[model samples]
Target: MSDSSTDNEASLHQYQDIQYSLKQSNRKTTSLFIERDGSVTVRAPLPYDMAKIESIIEQKRSWIYRNLAEWEDLNRVQVHREFVNGEGFLYLGRNYRLQLVDEQDEALVLKNGRFLLRRDHVDSGMEIFKNFYRTKGLDRINQRLTHFAPKMGVTFGSVRVMELQHRWASCTSKGDLNFHWRCLMAPLAVLDYIIIHELAHRLYRNHDAKFWDAVDKVLPDYQRHVSWLRHNGAGMGL
Candidate 1:
């Protein structure tokens, strides 16, 4: 609960329950958030006083370096995908490179390590790309859902995709499945796990052992996919 400000310095504010550290992230950010569930985070350059930051946390009678060390460990498990040339894009477990090409098609093309799309289709170019991926990705997921849902002893009324800021997927009590379009960036196994997880809710609707057992009945290696999402799913905009 410490706050410090200076006209010639960056503004610094500390919270009592923050579980994060100062970091030099490659992404553009100014505030960090650590979830109450033990996720450490960082906010990039804004305004701050280093001495005040130390003092504020110290007044809590907590170990200064211990918090820093915890942040280091948490950072090791964070995954941030850089929107840069030659960086790999994951779609259904396949890797593709982002390539800007001149074409009237205005769609995504997967060919030979490239995800080619129209270079100047809209004002917000990234939004166009995201939509392209979302459409195609939903098609794939729906196709798989149609194939697997029946086999897994579940039935869903519908499957839809939307732009969600926080969650990857959710299920309605009425048996509809809603998934985040960003899931297009995760591996195929991870995508399946999410779909199955939500579909399982059509029967159980809660995270009890029986629900997990239902999931395991379909995806025996569900734990691996869960860990994969925990470690790498954030890069997919989670």
Candidate 2:
């Protein structure tokens, strides 16, 4: 609970641009977290010595290396689309290259197994693409929610579409279902699985056995879709 490092003679307290604190936990080991503002904090038991904790963190540098490598891999694979020619987009779990064209009206046309973005009249091609997908995505989700919510004997107050960074969909205690707009890229069955998963939460808030049982009552093979989302979710992000 006290600072034990006494190598410095200037002052007992050392000034670091980043300060580290050790927290007491029930776990046998320590963990480190780098905060958003570039501060590093280590969590460990209160009885542990500061010098030993620092040594342990140094010994676990391999974990830091692994995490940095994962971050770099995610950054490399997460592609951002510009809604321009040659940009790749996903529809129904398949990839298609965007082909931009000058036309009288803004439209999304599919031809020759490619998505054509006719963006002559649209002020912002990206906005047009987003709006188009939003509408279609909302429609599909609404249809699935309506069909599944009733079967699960759960009534939802509202369903809304928005962009979520961390989750594909979430359900609030008030019976509202919120889905990410990027879910449009998934297949209809996959989207339905997410909807059903959220709707079941209306009955059981946490992912307990009862919740999973409720989900299995509706979707017998929900694991496959869940696995697909977990593995390929990053590519769905903008």
Candidate 3:
């Protein structure tokens, strides 16, 4: 739960007429983010005044522009997949070509270096692929959480894989974890980074210095995974 901006009740705001979305929470410090879709979001402390929030946003003006530009460049490769034969689908960061078949035991299956899809299932291809990712996401996220929770010295409640449109993962105050099924499209190393990020939230609710310190202890190289996701995330889609 990296405090990646959530759209829930986020109000439209502006600083010097620079439009952005504002999300206020109990966080101690204000932070800015360029979302995967290149939207500007500012997460501010609950008690902060509008003027103060505007000041921070003003301070980071240069950084915001640099990142938004990079986001544009990265998303240029955004994927638009079709259910037809020879179309490619992403699984674990690898692009596997889709092959339509008249007969298959399942709606979709990754077999022999390609994705085989039942031709009749093509109309429901989006849902079928979503189900495939969710099934795989649950298993892999659980396995990684089990392996890392002990190392991070934390216990969690239930874990679920679903459509988390904005963030890759989130955790409840009860310590239950929820991951975006799209996460299954990431490489193993990036998936682990997302796991550790949310699990660290069990120890600290905010992305403060101490919270990042916990993540760094486990994954000193985690920044590379972050870069990978920011650069390639747009292509991991239906």
Number of backbone-clashing residue pairs for each candidate, in the order shown: 6, 0, 1
Report the alpha-carbon TM-score of model 1 versus the true structure: 0.63
By lDDT, the better pick of 1 and 2 is 2
Candidate numbers, best lDDT first, in rank order: 3, 2, 1
100-215, model 2: which lDDT tens digit per residue?
77773537766787877776633466666667667878888888888998899989977778765456677888988788777788887888888888898899976557887898
lDDT of 3 by residue, 1-238 (tens): 2244444457776676456887776668888777756688888775546777788888987556434432333234656788998988888878899999999898899999999999999999999999999998888889999999999999999999997645677789999999888789989998998899889999998665787789899999977777787667767777
lDDT of 1 by residue, 1-238 (tens): 2233222332334455444445443445444444433344444443444555445455533333222221223233344444445656677667777776777465556777787755664345467657766788779889878877897778888778886535677778888777887677778878887788787888796555788788889999987777676556555541
TM-score, cand. 3: 0.72
Ranking by TM-score: 3, 2, 1
Q: All candidates' TM-scores?
A: 0.63, 0.66, 0.72
Pick by TM-score: 1 or 3, better one: 3
Q: Which one wins by lDDT: 2 or 3?
A: 3
Candidate 1 ranges beyond 4 A from true positions: 1-87
Q: lDDT score, residue 174, model 2?
A: 91
What global local distance difference test value does model 2 have? 0.66
User: Clashes in model 2: which pairs?
Assistant: none
Instruction: For candidate 3, list the clashing residue pairs, or say none.
Output: 1-198
lDDT of each: 0.62, 0.66, 0.80
